[model samples]
Target: MSPETTDLPLTLSADHYHRPAPEIPGAIALIEDAQVGVNLAMLQTGALQIAIDSQAVKPGDKLLVFIDEQLVLVSLVERPCNGEPIVRNIPAKCVPDGIISLSYRVNVEQSAPLKVLVKTELPGGVDPKPEAPGHFLLTPPQLTPTTLDGGQAETVRIAPYPGMRHNDVVMLKCGNWTLPHNVTAHEVGQPLTFTLSPEMVASNGDGAIVLYYTISDAVGNRATDHSLGLAVMIQTGSATPVAPTVSGVDQQNALYLSQLGSQTVTVSLDTRAFTAGDRFTLVWSGVDRTGGIKLFTQEQILERQTTLEFSVANNTIQELAGGSARLFFTRTDAKGGEQQLPSREILIVGNTRRVSATEASPQQAPGEFAAGGS
Candidate 1:
C-alpha cells in the first residue's frame, strides 16, 4: 500500500491559510467587467466598489488597485486615451455651484468619450447673488377721474411697472391725502393694475383736484419715478335753470293749439335743468261769455324731460267771451319762489268762421300759425 497518509502539524502547514493582501500605492486596478469613460473609471472588487480617474494610466499599462488599504487587484490598462471634451452648448440658466442638468450635444474624433462633467465657473471678481429690483417705469401713470362730485367717492386705477411683485405696495400722494395699498396679485416680470377709492378729494384752492403716486417693495425700497397728474373739477351749488320751452315751437312767447276734433294737445316739457322734487304748473286763463272767469291749471313734479297734454275741446273754447285766452308756464325751486316764462295767446277758430280775431299778427307767431292751421 502507498505510504501510510497522516495529518500534517498546524505549525508546519501555516503557508496554506487564507489572508488579506498588502496595501498598494501609486496606482489603481480595474475590476472585472469594469467600464472606462472619457474622464472616469469604475471599479468593483470583493465587497468594495469605487470610481477613479482613468487618465492616470496610459494604454497597455498594468496597475495595482487598493481596497481599504489592501491590495485587492492587478489590472491591465486596455482603454484608449479620451478625446478633448467637446461641449456645444451650456445650459441657458445656470446658478453658480448649483447642480443642474447641463444641456449639450458633444462630438469626439477619437474613441467614444466615457463620462460627462460640467463645471460652471464664475468670472473673476463677480458675485453670483440675487439682486433687488432696479428702478424702472415703462410709462407714467395715466389717471382718469370717475366723477367730480365732492360728496361722492372717486376711484383711480394705475397700471404698474414691469418686474413688480405681489409684495409691493403702492402709495398715493394727493394734496393732504396719503393712501397705502398693497399689491394683491402680481407675478415677477409682469405688469400689474392697482385700483384705489379715495374717500375725499382735495380742491386746489379752486375747484380742481389732482392725484399722483409712488411704488415700493415690502422692505420699503421705493422707486423714485414720478407720475403724471390727474385733474378733476368739482361742481358745487345747484345748476342754473335753462328755462322751459314748448317742443317744436321756436318762438318763446307764443303757443298755438289746433282743433283735432277735440284731440289731446301734447307738448314736451324740457325739464333737463331741473332735478327730482322740484314743482311746476301750467296755467290757462280766459274770460267766459257771461263775464265769468275761466281758469285751468295742472301741477307736475319734475323728474326728467316730461310731456304735458290738455284738451282744447269745443265746449271749453266756446266759453271764452272773445274766443281768446292766455297760457303761462311757471316753475318753483327749493323755495316757493316762482319763475314764469313769456305768455302765449290763443285764438279760437271754428270749421267755417274765426271765433276770435287774431290779437297778435301771424308774423309775430309764425310757429303758432303753422301749428294751429295744420
Candidate 2:
C-alpha cells in the first residue's frame, strides 16, 4: 500500500517552513531557461509540466507560480508509484504579462524565484506608428542657463494611439536622444506625455532632426512596426536678418492706403540660400486705426525664384492707421530649417478709407528700410 501523504501551502503559515527551491531536474529542465520567445501554440495546448522534487513535494501539496510579482497559477500535486511530475496544464491567458520574471513555489516559499523570459502580444499586423506632432516654438526660458543645467525640463504632449495598454512602455527618440515613459492604469487609452530637457535639444541643434516613438507591451513583446517621423529644427543664439524691402509707399517711408486704392504693399526679400519648395510666412503686428490690437499674416511657397515676395492686402494696410506697425517674416527651408527675421517698424500714415485706384510703382532704398524696434 502507498504511504500516507502530507499537505502544505506555498505561503507562510503556522505549519509551513521555507524549503529549498524546486528542481526542474532531467529533460524537463528546459523550462528553467525559458527566457526567450513565447510558444503561443504550445502554451494554448497545456502540454507544459512542472518538474518537482519527488521527495520535497508531497501528495495534496499546493504548487503556485507567479509572474511580475502577481500570482497567476495554482495546482494540486497528486501522487502514485511514479517519478514523473504532475503535468500542470496552464492556460495561455493565465500567464500574466511580465518583462523578466516567472517563478514557482511548493508548500512554502522557495529559496529563490526562477528567472523566466517570455515574449508575447507582438503586434503581428497592427499599426505601430505613433501620431505625428505639430511644430513648436521654444520659449526663451527653454534655452536659459537653468535648462542647460538640467534644472528645467520641456514638457511634450503625446496623442493616444490605437491599442495602447496599461503597463506598456513607450519611448520617444529624436536624433541621437531618446526618453521612455511607463503607461499607468489611469493613463491607458488616454493621451500620454513625456519631457525633454534643454540639454537634449541643444545637443541635437546641429540641423533638422527627425522625431519618432516606439512601444513595448508589458509582456516584453516589441511592436513589429516602424513609426512615422516628423522633421524639426531647434533654434537658439542670434543672427541678423537682411532688412525687408517694401514697395508702394511715399518717399518718407510712409504708407498711404487711401491713395494706394486697390494696390497692395509688396514686401520682398533677396532670397539668400533659398531653394524651391521653401515656405515663407509674413506677419504684420501693431495697433489698428482704432488703437486696438491688430495682426495680419500671409504665406508663400517658393517654386523656383531669386526673390521672396509677400503682398499685403490694401485693406490690411489701411487697417494699420495707428502711425506705425511691426512687419516680420520667417522662412522654412525645404529640409525644415527655419530662419526668423527680427520685426521691422514701418510707418502707416493712412486713415481707414478703402477705394479703387492705380497701383503704386516699386520703390527701394536699402538704407532707408533699415530694421527698427521690433
Candidate 3:
C-alpha cells in the first residue's frame, strides 16, 4: 500500500541563539616581530572582541596588515588568551630613532591590529655619540694666498692624512679673510708646490708669511677646525767658519848629569807672538839639549819661550861643585825645530866653587864644549 505525505508543526527556543552583529568597526594594529611575546597594546573600543586561536596566532608571531589607509605595519604581541589576539600601536617616528621597547603586556585576543601613522617633517640631523665626538665641518674649496720660499704664491695644494683620500679638494686663505687659491688635494706624507705671482711675491718680501688651508672629505662632510698655518722663510747664500786646532807641551830639565827618567817640563808661549801666525813645537826627550840623546818630539807655540831651572845632587859632578851640577837650555824655532846649547859644567875644588861661563853658540859642533870650561 502507498503511504500518504504528512506535514508536522516545528517550535524554536530562545536559549540557544547567535550574538548580534557589532555596530562599530573592528580595527587591527600592526607591530614588529621583535616585539612579539613582549608586553604591548593598541587603542580600540566596541564589542568586536579580539580573535586569534581559530585564526592561528602565537607569541613572538609576526603579521603584516593595513591600518586605516595610513600605512601597513608588522607587529608581534604576547600569547593570545582563550580565543583573543593581542595587538599594539607603535609610532613610526619612534622606531627610526631607536627601538620602542614595550612597557606593558598586550592582549592578542582583544586588542586591534597594530597600526602606526608616520608624520612627515624636515630632514633629521645626525647626532654623534658622547664617547665619539664628531669631526670638524669643512666647506667647499675657496681661493686663498700661499707663501713659499719667502715669496708669495697664487697656487698651493692642501692635503690631509690618515683620514683623507687622494685627489680631494682644498682651499687656501691668507690671514683670516683673504682667499687666494683653490687647490687639489694629494696623498698625505707628500709635499706640494705653489707658484708665486709677481704681485704676491712683492707683498711678501723676505719676511715669513702665514697661510691657511681647509681639507675636506669625499662625502662633503667638512672638518675646518683642523686648519694649519705654515711659515715660509727666504733662503740666503753664506758659509760658516771652521773650528781651530789646539795643542800643549809639558817638560822638565836637570842641572846635573845623572841617569834620567821621563821628564815633565812646563812650557808656555803666547799665540800672538808669531808675526806670521806660524806655530812652534816644544819637544821632550831623554836626549840632552846638546844633542846627546833623543826620546820624543812635541809641538810648542811660535816665538814664545819659558825658562825651567832645577838641580840634581850626585857623586858624578860633586867633585866639580860640592856635588854634581850642570846647566841645559832648549830653543824652538818658528818652524817647530828645537836647537840645543852646549851643557855648561861647574866644578868644586877644596873650598872653592867655580861656574863655567859660555854663550850658547850654535856655530860650534854639538857636545864639543869643555866639561869644566865655557
Best by TM-score: 2
lDDT of 3 by residue, 144-245 (tens): 532233333455544333344333334443321233332244334444444455455444223223344444332233332223234333222132211111
Superposed Cα deviation of residue 134, candidate 1 (Å): 16
For model 1, residues 241-340, the per-residue Cα lDDT tens digits are 2322333222322122342354444434566556677787876665332224577777877765554443444455555522234455677887887766
Measured on C-alpha atoms, candidate 3 has an lDDT of 0.28
Model 2 misplaced stretches (Cα beyond 4 Å):
1-125, 128-154, 235-374
Better of 1 and 3 by lDDT: 1
Query: Pairing residues by index, what is the TM-score of model 2?
Result: 0.35
TM-score-wise, the better of 1 and 3 is 1
Error of 2 at 371 (Å): 85
Residue runs of model 1 more than 4 Å from their true location after superposition: 1-143, 186-199, 202-206, 238-374
Best-fitting candidate, scored by lDDT: 2
lDDT of 3 at 294: 29
Q: Give the clashing residue pairs of candidate 1, or none.
A: 29-65, 37-114, 38-114
